[model samples]
Target: MNSESAILFTQCLQNDFTSLLDKYDPLPNSLHIGYAEANRLLGEMVEDGPVFSLMDWAYEKDPKQLKLIHIRDWHDPKSKSQEDHLLQFGEHCLMDTKGAEFVFQSWIEENPNRAEIVNASGLNDFVDTNLESILKPYKGKSIRVGITGVWTEAKVTFLCYDLKTRYPEFEIAVCSALTASSSLSMHFIALDQLKQILGVNVFSSIGAFTEFLTGDQPNLKKRISTNARIASDKLNLDPKYPITDLDKQILLYLFRDCKEVECKTLDGGFSGNVVLKTKSIDHLGHLQVPCVVKIGNRDLIAKERTSFERIQEVLGNNAPSIVDFCELGDRGAIKYRYAAMLDGNVKTFQKLYGTMLDGSGLDRVIDTVFGEQLGRLFEAASTEKLNLLEYYDFQHKYAKSVRNRVETILGSPQNESTIEIFPGHIVQNPCLFYETDLLDLKEYNAISHNTSYVHGDLNGANIIIDAQDNVWMIDFFHTHRGHIIRDLLKLENDILYIFCKIETESEWNDAIVLTDFLHNQEDLGIPLSFDPPREITNEKLKKAYRVHRKTQIVLS
Candidate 1:
């Protein structure tokens, strides 16, 4: 942290971070001030300054802390090797603290810190050879790369392009302090790489990208890579996918009781669901069992874990039992498990009904499986005693937000004409505008005489129907206590409004059946039901529905 170095850091930010500053508007002044403060502190510190470590003090402050740009891990000088390699990444970081520990043979294997700390260049042949075994665990996954010290431009280039090209399935997340003028050269490309890992194509170049990345849209960046699409596409647990030393060890731990375990990639999407079937020695003899493993974002897995505890508290034996749970590392991985894979999920049923919605079997299956389970869930949740009155107030606020979004759309000249034509089209073909009106209906007041804990995002996709017609809820990403309106509306709207907008035949028929169920939902056993006054169904509500529907189509 010398004066020359301090001046260099400030200059680099002024240049490379220009687009980010302009895009955020507020950052130009705040960041300059932050950097000035940071430069002042550099006089008393060395390589890693506490003042600079806060990240917000100097570089662009990311309010959500959405991106983990770099990481560092060092060995004590007194260790057996007596030599320090910069924070060695891959296996060392994954295993030294968590995952599983490695056992060494003899002094011949004394080289624990074998891989050199990668700098701003290519991986050496030794690193190329050893990195395979280390990264094998993350073959079709994302990982956090560690930089021993500060990250330079060349290092960023090698990481973003080279590492990405070499390991296409593996996404990279790193945390590091920016250093040297090197980063100034490729900051734009680095932004692309960052957004790519986040599974977004928002920035075609440095200019367009910074607009949103530095704006007041913290939630969007936080949610960028957390979607099911990325989760579904990346993981490849197929046995044919290849395994290395560490992969075998992981398998052994996962199937501790099993011998001759064979894993195969299932049709599960995102959220990393794979089936592991194996033979185990029991009291009688060898027996076969099937278990499902889920590896995904730590937050989502953490949510499911919490849901498991709540289910056990309220609906014991009604849900799948959790087999295991573990956090891989900071900005790395999270694993989840269920004792066995069930018959099928609601998504499977929806797909099936997509072609066979007219069939009585599909209708009966939905009623028998979903109806019964939902009844029990609501019954159990009813005992929780939530404040429904306050929940309605929150719903009104949400409705207002939706209205604001609609007004924004209406204010845009490009959308004004489209809004004008919609009402006329609605009158000519009410069926065509049926879903639109439903969306427009903002009368979300009134509480069902019954109140209970509502699954915050209960869509057909989240519900799983098993062989015994038992229902298991997955992806409890949004779970809260309130009126059951959220769950019921989400299910109905997803099946009818959302799916019907894109799908055809049985899918539409399925929507129709679901719509009928909603209109006649008296016996649905949901704790909360609502009735709204005419005044509540404002013009903004309708416009918002239209705008939201259009946005969904475009984004999807």
Candidate 2:
């Protein structure tokens, strides 16, 4: 309706047409001849024929102009043939007419308006002179050329070859005097002969519509993509991916949703899921925005679907908007509003910052961008409340697993020396022990505080920042009511991971100290910050060191 929307619609139409046209324009395959070589070969065949004379007639009663060719064999109609003589004559005719009729018929069929060959004719003039000049008038236009007389497969092949190569824009057809039945017989025999003598499968040639004769022929029934057959055992499917009907229906459904939208298939490789992007408009036309269509296996996504439904009920506009959700047999598709302004995430920011925190004027930038934003986030979480009993239940369920994970990493005697894991030790045993220790500390266990709504996966990649610097969280596949500190720690480790990736052990330590200082800043809103080494003891450094070392190992 609007200019931008109209433009997008037009572009979509263009793309759809472009894609469809590709189906008709097949590349030259094994069955097709090289255009130039075909023309030359056809010319040679015609030139080697028994000499023929051409007669031109301008009709007096009609506007028709016709040319008739009298071949040496055709000129001997009056001769009565003995048995052996008749066979010899027939054989000679077949040889001479081999490729002639094919070329003539093709030309006549293709060039109805501009060119015509009324009867068998000698190729002496046409071949000796520039053939290009003879058909020059029909060069840029579609013309119909009429051809008559019986021809062998060899002649038909030659004729078809010449017409296709020399006058591509012309349509060739048999004369009306030649009935459709007669033409069909001629064509059938022509193809048979061509195959037998020339090894050319006319039906398999490029641009030929012979799909109906092949196993790969497309299914023409109307249906959804579910009917398609999966090609291999590796692909998750019912029977297998089909060649025709299902593919068309999918495109049709997509077109119906967003009139001029183009789909980019982003299948979850080996996951048996199909993801696509389309201009967002549902069957009911509620919203006209870009959206993602995720079609997943019903068996795999039942829990995920429940999670999405729950999130929609609880978060409202704080999360991505769901458009249409439907189940098509065993699989389902969910259309959700897509964000066009999503710039990048936390990982993006850290990678961009690089070692800039070590550079001048950047420390102030870091304080403003990260320190202030994180401070606000923590402050926001503190104001939210969670049920006390539910909080304890979550802590109890994960406490033992956390303890085991910590013990496994730190239990090894070889992990005692810091030098053994100095660089990226954060992901190693020492880091795990530190996290587990923090969980077990009396200060953490003694407090009965409200657990708030927290992003379950709070990594930098999950946090999307827009052009205006506003942050948004995505991928709530893991959303749950969890501890506020869990989100905070995840964000901290993400930031630390970046440093470990680019900085040495000393640089990593300096970054860890800076992060600690920012969290401890006055009014920064964190419930608690890293204590000084004298207070928490130098043992805390081992955790930070382990975090860096683990990060290094994973990256390597």
Candidate 3:
């Protein structure tokens, strides 16, 4: 075996230990906490478990990398010593019974098999056992001892502490996913406590075993990411998106034909999904096909796949196409073509056209985008739908309609708003323009007579400009059979709030005035005047007007 190797210690994976999953009172002397959480850990503990997967990965794939030691929670049945084991957790894991046997059928009953077996009782696992003599050979070699199994607060914790102290040099890695506790909270708390001890590494997912085995740098930097995801649905835990090792396993499966593949988080992240740019390299070290991968909430990414477009020349124009879609446990993953620019620069409209007139913003390129690309998008919206009233309710009719659609965090509209925005700055509420009585059934169809499959959130960040200055849209979670007018309005707002970035009251006033002027121009069905009208001349605001004019032509 290699000197730099590893060993895995799986504890309490026995019939008797199954009592921890009892729904009611559980075992009379069991450290059972709650059934639901226990069962969640159980789902991955036994049949096709992550731990078992690691065991197979090390042995079946490359036994030279690892060895296994199964620790059975066995207690002597004949002993009337009246110790704490009999008093607290009474008569559990009794010797010569099914309770004390290994749950996995492959584990040898006696010693000297592929995997070594150890029998320890209650809290006395570290006391006077053959465990020390068994460790005689692999003692000095720098090896990683992987810890897994039940009652994280008790046996797992105690065993890890003993290993850390006795074999201080050995890397003590505890697979958080493989272990359980009397209570779910204790399981997490124990992990945190164990981290304080030196030479101990608590891996949140067993997928991280690869990092330990190869001494690879940690992929998901924030160890508490999984916990944070579970703790809150809305917490922006990390500024950057993270992918687990299991996610990599799935990606490897997808890109198996490629010699090697690499992934990096893309620029846009407001969609609550990690957009990764994946590039493949062949044996020659030359770049091959590139794609975009998105990992996010299962429901969201899965829903995104429903409208996920594939490579097709719909109307003689191409868009980023979906490559594949899959579920990573509770998260969903989908990959698409990586749209690159002529100069090989992969930039969003936001990065490419800052304020649509700033340093990075090239009017010549943007003009081609406006004259050609965006027009193609709007033209594709030929499919008509007669649901203007439904849009009306969403737009202005409902009590919570306007605020719910406009005032939001990160431009993501929430369902409610308690505070008014930009009071006395410009127009107080946008709903002022969408008055209830002003909306008429006769005008509903007249206002928006056309429809198509529109991007629900057509922000500049989601719009990708490619090599030929063509547009490739991404982050289509909200894509639906909808109207082009909605997309036009959304694009208009993206330029207004996202790009303009109005700093002062005067800039805000200029933006408001310019917006009103653009609206009038859009209604007029003509090109905007050569200059900013209505005394609107904030250099930045004028550029906004120019971009708005191009949109006006598209709308016409």
Q: Compare the candidates by lDDT and give the number of the best one.
A: 3
RMSD in order of candidates: 20.3, 28.5, 19.1
Worst 10 residues of 2 by lDDT: 4-13
Give lDDT tens digits, candidate 3, residues 462-484.
87765566567777777655665
Stretches > 4 Å off in candidate 2: 1-256, 263-287, 293-302, 308-316, 326-333, 338-420, 423-447, 466-471, 498-500, 503-506, 509-556
lDDT score at residue 391, model 1, on the 0-100 scale: 48
User: In candidate 2, what are the lDDT values of residues 182-292, reduced to their tens digit?
Assistant: 123344456555446544333211101111111121121222233323122212222333222333343343334332444444334445565554443344544455555
| Model 2 C-alpha lDDT versus the unseen true structure | 0.36
lDDT of 1 by residue, 1-556 (tens): 1111010011112221212122234433221223322222221222222223223222343313222222122223344432333223312222133211111112113433322221111223113234344344445544323221122233334444545676675433322212221222233344345556543232211111122233221122222233212222222345554433333333443343343444553234444432232233322345544454544443455455444433343444444544433232211111233344443332344454344433334444445333544445565445334445454443333444554565565564222223442323311222223324445553446434544555677655565554455445555546555564456566546554654453444433343333343465464444322322233233322222332233222212
As for candidate 3, its clashing pairs are 33-182, 341-467, 342-467
TM-score for each prediction? 0.38, 0.34, 0.47
